[model samples]
Target: MTDKAKQYLELFLVFFKLGAFTFGGGYAMIPLIRNEVVSKRNWVEDEEFMEMLALAQSAPGPISLNTALFIGNKRMGFKGGLVSGIALIIPSFVIILIIAMFLVKFKENAVVERVFKGIRPAVVALIAAPLYMLGKSANVNKKNIWIPIVVVALVAFLSVSPIYIIIGSIVLGLLHFLYIKKIHKR
Candidate 1:
């Protein structure tokens, strides 16, 4: 096969494997994404991967799928994005389709219910692991650490909508940029 075709197939297979095996959800997939894209394939630098993770989280849709699209588009443009995204979702789609067909009948099974119960804490840890790594990469030092703490508090305790937090962060970043620009002009 041609080089381009090889690249597309690589993308598809990589994401297919991730989607097929990962248990929890999008957030839980972050570490696997980092392993594949940043370490294994060398598609993006560590900082770029972290930035993509942030963008994927802030934007609508699943983080895993968004990361796939962003990385694919960055590497090979629109076709790459489409292929990567479709491949990433295909396994999950198939699995869910099968599950949906039989889920109702198994919903009352004690073993199945217990399995889900055990998965919950594991999923939480999987999600939190990436958050900690991303936070450190984003420079969450003591000086600015309060920002994330406050946001988490708001969402967890106060039940604030994440939309407001995202918007507020954007506004804050823009204002900071302007402030620095004004200071430089003085």
Candidate 2:
């Protein structure tokens, strides 16, 4: 195979490993992805990784797939994107397929129900871990810290829809942007 082909294959294999091992979706996969791609392979720098992450979040499709595509493209161009995207998703596809088949056959079993019940709390904890990590990484300033506090308070006390929180964040972001622009113009 050509050098580019080999590179693409490597991308596929690396991402296949990441996808197979990571649980609890994209955010959970991030630190692992950073370790592998940035720390181990030296494929991208930390700042670049963060930028790709931001782009991945803003793009269409799953965050993992978007991340894989961006990194792969950076490494080996279009073919790398194809290989990495497929690799990132394939594990979940196969695993879910197998689980679906098994669930269809044995969902009513007491042992399976018990196992699922045990897994549920662990899954929630896994999801929360990434949120905690992101909060630390974001380094919220005094001005922005209240955004999360108000959102949490509203969600906890008032039971507001999450969409309101999202909209509020957007509004706050816009106001911050305008303020910064005004300050720069002065």
Clashing pairs in 2: none
How many clashes (backbone atoms < 3 Å, residues ≥3 apart in a chain or on different chains) does model 1 have? 0
For each of the candidates, the C-alpha root-mean-square deviation to the true structure, in angstroms, is 4.2, 3.6
Assess every candidate by TM-score: 0.67, 0.71
Of candidate 2, the 10-residue stretch with the lowest lDDT total is 126-135
| Candidate 1 lDDT over residue span 1-186, tens digit each | 999999999988888888889877786789998999899989999998898888998788888889989988988899999988998899989988999999988978999999989998998887677877888877899899999989989999999999999889999999999999999999
Model 2 clash tally, residue pairs? 0
Angstrom error at residue 18, model 2: 1.7
Question: Cα lDDT of all candidates, in order?
Answer: 0.89, 0.87
